[model samples]
Target: MISEFTRTAVPQLVGHELEFSKSQHEEKFHSLHEAESVIREELEELEEQAEVCRKLFEDLHSDTRQDDKDGAVINAKYLAGSAEYAAYEAIQLAAMCLKLVEMAGREDEV
Candidate 1:
């Protein structure tokens, strides 16, 4: 089941990604090939962030000391931050996909 936070947050993040991309790039995707390259790059970034989250989760599970509540809390917060970043990357990837769909639709109308 999807969490309420995710349902709302993902679309908002996708919109933010689109705005950021528009600001950073002078042109939108010119072709499906170009869009594929951009999507691939975003996927690589998402994979890297997911790996960071995975390592952090493993560390939190294995290294957290039962007596050191403060340290555990810190580790948990760090994990959450990394996970959030991964989610952000995912949103960017989704935005890229949406862009591809939009481009395809436009081509169809031509």
Candidate 2:
């Protein structure tokens, strides 16, 4: 009965479309948030690690961060690292959304 019902088909179609849109938007949002968070965390880590580098520089009386201006010029490095992690998280999110889409499609077929 369910397989032969047009009403059922209509709802599943609408649901799939809505889910596709919502999931895409949410996937982007999730990716953005994850990237932001990763950047923040990695920057903090780099700063902390730089401190260690600084300390090593200090113990040796070296000026490691001076020419770089407190790592001001290394934004690209941070983004590079952040982007690496971001892809993993974003891909996972996308896969999850696709799985949802696939499940919806399966239900629609039924």
Candidate 3:
């Protein structure tokens, strides 16, 4: 009698376990997809900012007058300083992303 009851209950328990596993898998995929989408968007925005920084640096250097040595030198220094700050910020952002990737890899290993 006990053996018969165990055989009958085991199949139902297995079926429920399979359903729970499938649901968990689906949820994990959805979360991964969302995270990828967000990372892609952030990369696009960073690329745009990088372009702007490049252009600003180029324009500043090109606009510097060889004839007006004093004023041009001052202006160039100011523009270059601004460009340096922007580049530093971009570097910081890249570092943050790198740290995040490293953390995710560690989590996966666990």
Query: By summed lDDT, which 10 consecutive residues of candidate 1 come out lowest?
Result: 62-71
lDDT tens readout by residue for model 3, 1-110: 56988677655554454355345543232354555664466566667766666665565566563455665566567667666655544443444344345446767999
TM-score quality measure for candidate 2: 0.35
Candidate 3: C-alpha lDDT: 0.55
Candidate 1 per-residue lDDT over residues 31-93, each given as its tens digit:
779999999999999999988888877777665645566766777899899988888889899
C-alpha RMSD of each candidate structure in angstroms: 2.2, 17.5, 21.9
Cα lDDT listed for each candidate? 0.83, 0.49, 0.55
Ranking by lDDT: 1, 3, 2
CA error at residue 29 for candidate 2, angstroms? 21
Tell how far residue 76 is off in model 2, in angstroms: 2.7
Q: Which ten residues in a row have the lowest lDDT in candidate 3?
A: 21-30
